[model samples]
Target: MRTSWSPAALDAALENVHRAGMPGLFAEVREGDRVWRGAAGVADTATGRPVTADMRHRVGSVTKTFTAAAVLRQVESGRIDLDAPIGRYLPELVPGERGDAITVRMLVNHTSGLAEYLPYAYPSLKAFPDLANTGPQSLEDHRFTRFDPVELIGMGVTAPAVGTPGGTPGVYSNTNYLLLGRLLERVTGTTAEECITRDVIERAGLRDTGFPTGPYVEGPHSLLYEAWFGMIDPPRDHSVQDMSWVGPTASLISTVADLNRFYGMLLAGEIVGPSSLAQMRRTVPVVSQEGKLIDYGLGLYPMEAPPGRDVFWGHGGTVWGGGTLAAIRADGKRRMAVAVNMQRWNRLDSAGRPRARPLDDALAAFHRVAMYG
Candidate 1:
């Protein structure tokens, strides 16, 4: 028997999100044919506009799932080879023995061991935590910078590899996906965004999702705020900024309803053949910097639910201030997408350890409600 989803319970969970210091939170849950969407707090803190279920937000790294799916579509068409070395397609871009050693499979599963470029490109955010909030010049200077994917990959490859290619205990790197995006372009003779939209978004029938060509979110959306943790007098509005730095790795704009639909179709094998989906679900251990272990699949993360709840398969994404979690049950009978308009609440303490934060609690609560309800 399915547990009854309580609107009151969901509302309370969202209130906890707001109480945890986010400006707003929105979510959508689906079980069988039933759907539930809820919103809490203000979309714009200054105007007090309410967040709605339809509002678009930067779904961030969750875009990897779409990118991976698109690449897999090419795999099904014989246009790409999952086991082939990335160097085969983009010899000029990848270059050297490292490139030859890194296979498409390694990139998709984040086993390529490529170091992330963001910390190196935006060093201020990594070096000085205070600058993240104190109106650091680097933040503003780089916010609108249009970084080429090649340059970003250069930044990553130049850094030390996290481990050998196809190594165990995969280290998550945005750089791997950035290269995959470039690989898609090389193979399809189209922009990565175009390929993803045509092959994944369009195929999934996601009318509300698209790759934004500019910094601004079109249509209805909430104000995205980056909470710098008192570096500035108040949290900065980062809703507008070019996302090219991250490219297909984290630049997709979508709504909760669209996210749910995409995952639903994906988990049901409508986007790829059963064999490709099996490849996508191939498991690897992803160890966090803090030593937490999460079982990561090719494009998805299989999140173990709390006791008595079903396991969830999907991905979570975070941009400057916005955060999103999208998942479907193992049986594909239920799915959910949760969005919060604030980011960086999971701050590190003086010892460089993550401090206990309420946003974590809010997420856990929402997951329980989404699963059991």
Candidate 2:
């Protein structure tokens, strides 16, 4: 029989990850009946700080959940139409013009056939990479390198069209979520930042979730180390504020506790109606890692992990510096979230590049809560 791990086991594993590699990491695990939240390493390995639930970390693409929620809210309010050409609202964004024959649906589902950031990757990783400054760039500054949302939009414009108007699907392009973020900003008079705060955060009663307006909040925050690149030699020197410019595409930092509370409220209909939430979770077609069909849900990615009887639904995020994995069981009784400052999505092991489906081991530990720890 397969051995099951425990919450304690998961904690130990996280601590192992902390000691061996992730020096500045905090993990939060909320299971069916118990909760274990701990700071594995230092928030700032350099200065020595502990990570707290209030500690903020850039959520990266996980911010899509917030952007999705806002868009669905608009859909719920009749302010936007899912099938309505994204151009009806933003004419400059008309489909098929910029190699994107995407409707709002395609944009959210990552099926727009746009390039992902694997410019020099396994095959197709055109998710936006800077060819000009790939050499000796500070990890932090290299990513937060300033550019408006419109510039990000332009990145989508150049992404090679993979399929004929969403015909052959199966590429995870960050541009789709990026476009959704921009569309949300345009449809609403307020920016995605303000709307997410007012509509999603406050409404969901998520005290720990909020946007990083400027430099890191003058309080405790997770000081991440780029284990893959910025771990030694010359460290990426820049504040969290520098990375916030990614805006709806990436920005929107929050805590694990807040993320758990937010997703919990979302599943429980506390923040959004059933239809609106359903709209956000709308699943679409995509090629799986196995080269089979998979469900790339709207604003959310759902998959059935091994060793589990049921599917875990949620989203993950990746930035230049950090990565996050947040998931909730189908029953809504189990919710887990883990955010790590170490983003080595491109890390390669002996077998190949090791790709960890994360919530910082949140779900793995969460799975243990039922069987062992």
Best by lDDT: 1
Tens digits of per-residue lDDT, candidate 2, 30-86, equal 665567776677666677776564577778777877778877888888877877666
lDDT by residue (tens digit), candidate 1, 1-373: 3567677887788788787777898999888888889988898988999999899999998999999999999999999999999999988867889879999999998889888887777766653323223334566788788888888898888898888998888888888899999898988999999999999999999989998888889999998888655454467778897999888999999999999999999989999989998999988987643356777888898887667767889998988878899999988988889998887655556765547776778778777777777
Q: How well does model 1 score by local distance difference test?
A: 0.84
lDDT of 1 at 21: 75
Model 2 stretches astray by more than 4 angstroms: 1-7, 95-100, 116-145, 228-241, 287-294, 345-373
Model 2 lDDT, residue 315, Cα: 73
lDDT of 1 at 365: 77
Worst 10 residues of 1 by lDDT: 127-136
User: How many backbone collisions does model 1 have?
Assistant: 3
TM-score of 2: 0.80
Against the true structure, whose TM-score is highest? 1
